[model samples]
Target: MSRSTPNTAPDGSSLPVVHVAAGVLIDMQEKVLLARRSADSHQGGLWEFPGGKLEPGEQNRDALCRELEEELGIQVRRARPLIRVTHRYPDRAVILHTWLVTSWEGDPRGREGQPLSWMPVAELPHWPMPAADIPILRALDLPDTYLITPPGFKETALFLRQLQQALDKGISLLQFRLFGLPASGHEVLARQACRLCEEYGARMLLNGPLKLARAVGAHGVHLDRRSLMALNDRNGYEGLLLGASCHDALELEQAQAVGVDFAVLSPVLPTLSHPDAEILGWEGFSQLSQGISIPVYALGGMAPDLLEQSWKQGGQGIAGIRGLWPSSV
Candidate 1:
């Protein structure tokens, strides 16, 4: 539903070529189907939300039927619009139309010889995915808040403990992001944090540390803008939730391509972290959130009290470290 870049022709020419891709959202017992791509292709070996490029004259549903059949060897019995996104990669531009297809026939086999897997929704954060997919993940789970944090250390430990107390008071989903910590220290803190999250039955997303997420048994991994732009597709990891931090519409589309669960659209308000960054006010936030099928948490200077306002302006919730862990809301 978000467009990061303007549309363009696909043949490396100036003529406009609107690329339409149709995808199906297969929900089965809380698990969804995903496919891996051949590493040699545009997005090789990456696991992706199963769907394919649309051909000329094909309706959205018709295109979905064809792609699912060709790629997964299955027939969709029912399908409905879920979301639509437009992303322009350097090499290709695509308009992605997605549908929620809850019913189907035949077991999903990777007809293209790409690997196939059924992933549980709750476990979506662990995969290595494209950045644009994050919002979709958010759409599926609908977490109330996106918790950001500084590095894990003795000083931040108190903050985390305070966060833990907040979790006890009903903050179920959180991200343990420490950009400044050493790898070893991060692992140690992640392991400790995982214990707390598990105790509270809360979900934790590690920012930019897929390996550490696995090592510490965290719920999932969060990708920043840089990590996502580099990925061609998402398909490898068998089990895990993948999240992303996205700044624009194109990134959100890419996140969807790689099957990210949810995303954080930042700078809803300016932060001390980057005082010069332009804030995406409620108007801008609404514009972005409107196009996204997945839930979007308004980041940058979010406070607990902003929840109602965010939802009113088309946000799922608010995500922040300072506002989330403060002694008062």
Candidate 2:
């Protein structure tokens, strides 16, 4: 197994990080279990997924099963990786390995005498939680596949027709990346695409300027690495969903620092378009993403069928251009 490198502190010192295995136990009603940390513990009083530190030589799944049994008094019968978050606090860093416990024996109780509750998924954001849990919520809200538009289609009518077909087939999250088009043309197509997406109750993100995204009434903007690096802060994007394209760990860190809602980490495999680009195999991707506290989509050479693989490797989902766009169209 690959291990993540320690994070550097502000003064250029390495920070010791504890790896924790946590579980999101969802009941039949779809409400998720949350536990409040003890007042004297680190990040005390914050609501968190019930879990504990991984014991030496313990596998993540075994650790989760052990923690759930000990902390919640439930034996995990079935579970899977949901998300992994790495958060840096002033004193120490933590790598939170979160699992979705689908089935368990016995009912959950606060075996450790901690405060516990099962909150509706919709209400999760309103509750105060540890900083690391934010991305877990976001991951839960997103779909398994994110579609990006290719620049091949030159006509707006043709593009919209294809997009409608895709939406009809249940592609809910889309990125309108009309690169190299004239400003006027791009805006016109974007507005139409946004309207089309709204009609389907889907979300459309413009892969261009923030102003263009807003002007066209897009749900958000998808920034390239250049734009991500150029941004000074996340103030103006408060009302919108922000996503960034990242190629490496440094760029992923930058994206997280700027408060983007999610990120697309690319070249997880060799791609037809960028065939020569360096690939981050599943191991490398997992290692690089270990401490990231944001939903990351595996972007290069991905298809809907790869969603399961992506999840196992700690990705929220898979994102692609060619793979999602039907060749028959």
For model 1 the TM-score comes to: 0.58
Q: List the candidate 2 regions with Cα displacement exceeding 4 Å.
A: 1-16, 27-29
**How does candidate 2 score on lDDT?**
0.86
| lDDT tens digits, residue span 84-129, model 2 | 8777777777778888888999989999899899999989999989
lDDT of 1 by residue, 1-329 (tens): 22223344432455444444445455647787777778897667666778776665666677788888988888889765544544445555555665667788888888878888888886776876544454455555656687776544456568667777788778888788775767787688778887888898888877765677788988888889998877666564346767788888888777756777777888899888779988888888878865655667789888888887776666767888777764642
Q: Kindly report which residue pairs in candidate 2 clash with one another.
A: none
Cα lDDT for residue 103, model 2?
A: 95
User: How much does each candidate deviate from the true structure in C-alpha RMSD?
Assistant: 9.3, 2.9
- Looking at model 1, report the run of 10 residues with the lowest lDDT sum: 1-10
| Cα-based TM-score, every candidate | 0.58, 0.88
The global Cα lDDT (0 to 1) of model 1 is: 0.71
